[model samples]
Target: MTGNAALTTPESTAPQSPPEEPSVTVSGSPGETRRRAGALLALARFETRELLFQVQILLFFALDLVYVVLQMTLQEGMDDYPVLNQVDRATQPEPLLFAIAVLVCVNAAVLRSRKHGTTQQFDVLAMEPWRRTVAHVLSVVPYAALTALLVAAEYLWEALKPGAIGHGSLGELAIAPLTIMLAGIAGVLLARLVPSGFAPLVFVIAFYMAMVVASDAAAEGKWWGWLSPLVFPAYFPGDPVPADLLGRPAGWHAVYLLGLCAVLACVALLRSGGRTRAVKVVTAVALATTAAGVVGQLPHDKAALEAARRAASETPEKVQSCTEYDGSKYCSFPEWSGVRDDWSAVVDRVQSLAGGKAATTALTVRQRIDTSGGVEADTYIEPATTPGQVTVGTRWGGNRVPEFAVGVATVLVTGTEKSVLQDMCDARMVTIMWLVLGNDPSPAKTFQNVRLDDSTEGSGLLLTPTDGIGMTANQSTVVNELLERPHAEVAARVKEHWTELTSAATTTAQAARLLGVEQPKEAEKCGE
Candidate 1:
């Protein structure tokens, strides 16, 4: 009776273990897994929206637009210099802006929870740490996409503009987005590895400096230059990149960048979450694979590039497609035969100036297509009694007045003595200008359209006394006086003693004397 009574009493009621806490299983079912995934996606979308509306991002867009407009303006200003335009477009503002945006946005996203002291709260949730890291990284995708779209739009606008030469290929278009994504991944990994808030910015700035060094090295054709994603070959006004340089190497460069991005991503993933043995092993294997990919993408030896250029320059099979005029054989690549007529006309005019003396020289003229898609004229003259063998190639585009003048000057000066006197050079330049414009004294008709300008001080002083050469004001006065005479008279005087006049030893005053023109008493001060 006493034991039964005690059992019924509260104190004796079997000190019951606290109601078995109902086995709160934190492990989730499939539905819970799906819900967490949905939640992560929602979080990513929210973060992306926040990034898109940030004041910095909006300013970046405005600056990008300004850059494009500036580029367009500069393009118009440099229309005569195609190489400058290509270089300007290649190094445009898009790449720098994209990189900066990725670094800023990704760093902010990865550090958001920590900045707000919410990391521990997030850790208590059913979601894994690695999954959260991935969501934050994925949030950068829209920004990268937006950057790519902006780049594409700029390129499209450039292509649509009148006289616009497209800058890069379809493959190059991928470089911007790929580089941005790589920056984001790198930012995330840096955030995980470094405790300081400014770690990512420091790393990005350091990387930019490294890229500048790599770019300089790449210009020297070093293999390590390829390590920098921003290093790309620039095509100048008349120098185009070779087809080989643009082909397989481009693909390899893209792969190299992508592999770097993959490596950073895998390292970030391993460092963020559980760090399970399997994750470590997988990360190790991935690191090795990507490292190999990067090593394989290094550029081949510089000799390979030289060999390719040699191959491209070898003489073609169809040497018979040549035009002959005035003892000169003008031949071009079969595809470029259409330009022969224009070249022949210029040659005819030069021959007329020589008065049949040029016909005695055996000249072989060949047209070469430079890497920049411009035509170049290579002229070779066989050794003769007048001069030794002569070979000259045009520096700029072919068949233009400057090129023609250069060709004629090469013939005129080849057999003559060489001198570097300012007056002599000025005299020869004036003679060449006369030949280029015939009897026309119009400045616009001359090579490069060089002209004399009056100074702003209204002192009756002229600017550019001798143009690019050392043409003194006195020499310019003599040239103008000579041009005002009868065309036949001037041509006769020039042709009579062409050898003496073209000789570099002949000074401008001497030439003027020979042409029966009186020199000015004093030289006019240039830009007075």
Candidate 2:
């Protein structure tokens, strides 16, 4: 008999049966072979759950659409600014990204936890071990795929934006997804093997942390910063990444993720001492991988030093042009202007000592725009809003769902308002109204029928004075400060450094309803 009828599981190399000789029936058991085949098939089906990332995929498309719209609406000659601004916005992060992550992780964890609610680990103890284990793993495939898809979509959209370079190449594409894949795989592995909600939660915090670091580095076009892969980890910079510094390519990231999946799967297989050894081996391999990654980046530092030297050789800073200036916006760094080659340490020193907001090169809101052609003078702002229905995308597909509405409208800036006391009073009133209207009905298990409470509603409408509304609980200090400052001075300061107190900027009608006051013509804008 042909012995090729073995190896029932696709991923496994183990033999399934003993072959017979010359038509003599020689087999361990047909039942065992059939069982292994079923398990392998189930595992394949389980992996197909990646299709469900459609929800995250849908959201990816939606966010990209917003990014596109923002990119498009930039005033003529302002394309580069939007892309740069987007780069910066992608850095610090807003709550929206966090919420999306939380939703994906929590939901995945919940699904995994229910199945193994009473064990150190989820015991896939069944007559058909393979099939059950596959099912358990398949459960989190959607979340993992969705997370990966969303990161990819955002990175691609950013790279494709007008004036976006470095993104057109294949090498550019793989860098970012590799990091995201690692992050998502990490989350999936944790949720799968940890058997607690905390696993996914910690994974998400780490994921966001990585993104924050990577995004910050990208904003500056610093090649060395690619190592972070911490917050917003992706290597898809629209710039040429030199070969010397590109040690950890996206392929390595994929290997890392696959290895992670293997480790997590082993957790389900480890029911006894022998299987536990497999876990140890996998853990050791993972640790070794981490060490390798660290070693790979060491040479990057040397490469950066060499590149800096070459740059200095080509364009030596002109020592003569080092004249003094007002140092207000353009500090007296004139001496270092032409002598960049020698001013290596000088450049770092001045930037460090210049102090916040007053630094020679301030990254605050500025009016300079650099693009494909040249620079321009203009201010670009994209009205990015989370629509009523938010779509999430996955590698497999996408899904659109209703969003929890959040908007903030300005009632009045303390100094800019006709009446400081009135702004405060009006803000307080509006806040109370919103709290009542926007009350969450679910926690109380009631429809949106909760009575309007002065306390909660006030909290909702009152935006920070920095933006437009709100004050209370011995509000004398704040009110007095606003009252003391001139309207023009206060308004100017407020406009330049505004932070939203209210998360949800409501419409005029919404604001009106919140205040129980007639709609004021001035408060027409969503964020007055």
Candidate 3:
């Protein structure tokens, strides 16, 4: 019985079997994976809704919307036709105000658990700290997407305008949205590292100050300035270089920004105790990408670019194409080919007022810009030295049309821009002013439009995009009086005394008398 019991013990009675394994459940089973994914989705949705409800975030984004609308409707700059290449860059920084809101709010959201002493509450949750951190980072995506749409709308508003010129850059348009993403992720990273409410404020101040200093350096043409998230070259109004002349490494900058955002994200994940192999690999790749972009943007073949710029500026005739419109020649860069018709219309209107050789004289309206000092320079294009050649700029429409009309009239009256720059303290100034304003439907409005200051009766500088002429107070009064008369009547008098009126030696009183307008009693007479 003892022998039988040894052989047939209870454990071995049924069957010979291996030691029973502990109840092992596979960690990456399909059900567990599904549950994890569902949890992540739920967490991301919750965080996004939370951010959307934040009053400060909604307020700033609303401000952004209102600002964009105002820019399109009430702004004078928008009324002036845009140079597409520069317009994209010009609109890039516009979303930064909204970005600041996202940064601060997102940082606060990430630190909310720690601040409220609910850090332990997440221990029972299905999602880990890193996953929760990822959800917060992702929550910023909707705001970034919204900002992208705003930027697109702003760009399209300008690009679709009748006289928009040049080509827009896709690389440039990508910047604002990427910038939003970067800001959001940066906020999460900052909170993870510092866990302090004041961290966002400190970061914002330091970041803004750095950008200010970097912008100044960029204006000075330092290559290191490309390292900044946004590089705004000192833009002077109405100065736009051709698309090819910009030479901005916008593509690389966009890549750099994207990589930086990824690096920040992965670092945040690592800080949240994710130490995963995948996260480590992504961080390494992101760093490599950022470094490559930096190297790519460090200014290439600058000497060649400068040479090309000089050629485009000093001798545009070689690079420009000529178009014949109604007996006048309009020469412009490749981008302004469509704009020649608009220029021709202004020339036709101005030349129609001339009496002798000034009338029907074929003019060469050469589009010019100074790129030697680069686009950042506040370049004043001096008067064109070529006779019978009037100067026009890349910008058109709005006040630009009338300014161009003034240029055409000056060239027609003085025979060259060189003579227009000479001492014009003479009756010829009255005739030139009459030619510019008399044909306009609103003479006084046109007069105000062409001056630096909107003064109708003062010794002020009369402006054109390319150059300006000074007008005496007496000359202004005479021109104003002539404009008040019937167009047919004044036009006849101007035609009759065309020769004497345009003569530099002619006195203001004699020219005013010829035009049948009262002479000013003020001592500020023409030719003084």
Candidate 3 similarity to native, TM-score:
0.92
Evaluated at residue 410, the lDDT of candidate 1 is 45
Best by lDDT: 3
Which should have the higher lDDT, number 1 or number 2?
A: 1
Model 3, poorest ten-residue lDDT window?
519-528
lDDT of 1 by residue, 71-126 (tens): 65664432322332233335333667757766777777778878988878976786
Ranking by TM-score: 3, 1, 2
Local accuracy of candidate 2 as per-residue lDDT tens digits, 447-522: 1112122232112223221122333322222222333344444334332332231223443333333323344434
Candidate 3, residue 422: Cα displacement in angstroms equals 2.8
Quote the positional error of residue 73 for candidate 2 in Å.
7.4
Question: Which candidate leads in TM-score?
Answer: 3
Give the TM-score (vs. native) of candidate 2. 0.37
lDDT at 522 for candidate 2?
A: 40
lDDT, model 2, position 121: 52
Please rank every candidate by lDDT, starting with the best: 3, 1, 2
Model 3 lDDT at residue 511: 85
TM-score of each: 0.65, 0.37, 0.92
Per-residue lDDT of model 3, residues 332-449, tens digit only? 9999898898888878777778887778788999999897566746688889888899999877778888888888888888888877666588788888888888778888888998
Task: Give the poorly placed runs of model 2, Cα more than 4 Å off.
Answer: 1-172, 175-184, 187-194, 206-228, 231-290, 301-528
